[model samples]
Target: MGISTDSTPRYTYQLPVAAAPSEPPSAAEGAAASLQDALLVGNLLWFVRLRWVAISALTAFGAAGLLVRGAFPPLGLRPPTGWPFLIAALLLLANFGYLGHARWIVRNPQHRGAAWNLWVQIVADLLALTVVVYFLGSLETAAPFMYLAHVVLACIFFPRWQSFVVVVVASGLYAACVIVERLEIVHTPGIYLDPLLRQAMTGHSAFPWVTASSALGIFFVVWFLASHLSSLVRQQERELADANVRLTIAQRDKTRHMLRTTHELKAPFAAIAANAQLLLRGNCGVLPGEAAEVVRRIAARCRRLAIEIQEMLQLANLQSADEQPKPLRLDLAEMVHWAIARVGAAAQARRVTVDADLAPAHVVAVEDHIKMLLTNIIANAVAYSYEGGTVRVRCHVAASDGPVITIEDEGIGIPADKLPRIFDEYYRTEEAVRHNKDSTGLGLAIVRHVAASLEIRVQVESAPNCGTRFTLRFPRAG
Candidate 1:
């Protein structure tokens, strides 16, 4: 419904800058403009149908003229039945042609043709309206008001100058129609459709000129108001869009700043944990029992915090990193075994049995990403499982399913309602937190991020007491 009449809007798109905030380009603007083109197409269809209605009305008026011609005297008014029918028939043919052109334009994807077709429709309608004006008595009837519809439509669909061009064209055409008839340049039986109205204006030599001037002024006033409002609306839209883009850029910059700050704290935390360990291990002089116990607790908390910090940094790095530059082929069986080994200590600590059903399958991906992805899943399975529970890992290539990996565990399972948030960074369900208080909650977030980077699909299934299953499906290689 909104239209721009001032400067053409410019659209551009660019990736977010790393060091400073900047406006991203309007990357998908063609898609945006297509909506307007689509709207224009719909409006054109509506107007084409409107013409059909006009044709019907004209035909009905002509029929009424014929019916009236026989019963009424020529004293008061006389309407020419044949001329009205001729105009309607001509309009019917033009409407059909316009409709066929519109259909042809829509069948093609390029919208440039649709715009030109609108130009033709508007101009052709104007020319037809001019004829209607002459027949209905240009200065005598209300036919000139019909020109305002096209004038308003032009302002909506085109820029200011083009709309003014339409206004000028309308004014000139109406003036010409009135003068020609008044001067008897093209003689007809009556100067007006209503004979009595023609008689009333016959003596007034300046009536046609005065009427034409008033109508021309009306067209200019309408264009000024419509085009001005349209320009204002479009400018506001652009300003709002730019403001939104700036807000998004500012938010992204804030996250990058926080993650960079977190990354910087990693070494200090590591050193603190190392020193605490040293104190507990008697690398320094032996501490008192109470001091030793406090140091032991301090070391554990530092190590866990260090792990959380590392995972947060990794998530940030993964988000900013480009796709693996030089991926290589690797055996899933070997990688799965390695990932199991990575989590073997945790499984042992929790008294959880880890089983692997590894089949020979080859996949191409960044070795480290897939390795970490699998390790995280296996580690999670072991972490959530009850003592003496079993965790199974499966890796195989199915004929239709391509390469697949599934890690299933008999753990304190996620609730159905909370399953969707399991991959959110630092997100853990109440049950997950209760079962394993040490979780960083970034394990599956990392897994899902890596899978997405590799274009792999992930599916999760779980029940409250029945544990959870994580399935990783690699897209079939072409």
Candidate 2:
């Protein structure tokens, strides 16, 4: 006979009786590619956001001061008596406004539209800044210094082709300004070059060509230095990134090796202990009193050591496993049946009965990982159970949630204070320690790791002297 219900459940169990529904690549390259892309994108975003703010602010301040000065008085030449300075002022203001918007967007990257707008505004501002510099100073005058800002901006914000383009455009604009000023179309500063001895005695003039030539030369030098520096920085970033990846991999491998070694050592010990128990039980032949007692103690200690090794191995396995998961369709009903079948015999000895109500549903998960995860939870339910206790495993499926598997046991329940620490390695409740001293205190810890790897949300509910319940919910696949 099985537990009767209005609806037929997937799995049901009775003492010596059952009704059941049962069942049961490139990874490395993809992981590396994903890691590389994440780092590259992250770095690009940082540089763009930081440098854009700095350049835009300085450009706005300088343009505003120029506008204010030109509006008031003049230096030897007449004020730009037309739309030139006015247009420059407006462009500078717009650039400054957009820079402020960009800063806000940078801070809140979750707003995709704002971030996009910021990028567009930065590009427009760069263009506007280039034009303003041309009007303020031509190659023979202040144009050279203007290009210096563009060169620096290019080196920081834009990379190869774009940086080159900005420099060339600034230089070309400066040259054009020089020609117009010299023709008397625009008010251009005059140059008075001094001899080497004369220049040593007096400071350089405020002339166009002389100053433009010097400023333009400085622009080139700074541009070269910035380019060289950026290259070095990029190289160092890449090296550090590579080293970090190597270190992670080395750490994972080391953990895996240790776990595997622990498992290897544990297997032989388990076999020895099993044989010793059989001999002591007289499964082969009757043993003397002293020999039987000694065998029992040896077997018991071996069992304890085996559990410790198993726990260690589990930790090692989880630490070294792939970060990226391999997902596949999983049948919740079948997994419940399979898990019960695996741990059925162990529970029977303690007279613990399993009552599972799993529904027919599919979720995505790694097959072996899911099984190992369930085994730890179900086995624990059975192990902690008292004689003639019941372990109920229920699965619920909803339109929103694909499947929720809950394992609840009516046994020596955990205390409220100790529930939080139950998942920690080497931790056991006072009740558990008193009831069973052989526990290695790693079952729930392993369960936690497996749940995390599969992206499944797991939680527990317990009341002292009542029972414990562990629930695992799996997200639905699209």
How much lDDT does each candidate structure score? 0.77, 0.65
Alpha carbon lDDT of residue 318, candidate 2? 68
Which stretches of candidate 2 lie above 4 Å from their native place? 1-128, 135-243, 281-285, 304-328, 349-351, 385-389, 411-431, 463-466
| Tens-digit per-residue lDDT, 1-478, candidate 1 | 1112245332211111122222233422444466667777787788889888889988987897787675445545566658778888987888888788778767875845667767887888888889878876787767898999999888877777888888888988988988888887886655344655676875577777787888888889998998898778767866776666566556556657768888789889889899998898899999999999999889889978988887776676566422345788888889999998988888899898998999988888878877888888898988888899889889889899999988888877767677767777789988888878898989888876787677777888776666777777887655
Give me the displacement of residue 239 in model 2, in angstroms: 8.3
- Which candidate ranks first by lDDT, i.e. highest? 1
Clashing pairs in 1: 12-25, 12-26, 13-25, 14-25
lDDT of 2 by residue, 354-464 (tens): 998878878787676677788888988888878888899998887676688989887776666666677777888888988878788887777767766666777777655
State the lDDT at 294 in candidate 2: 90
Model 1 residue 363 CA deviation (Å) reads 6.0
Among all candidates shown, the one with the greatest TM-score: 1
Cα lDDT for residue 293, candidate 2: 89
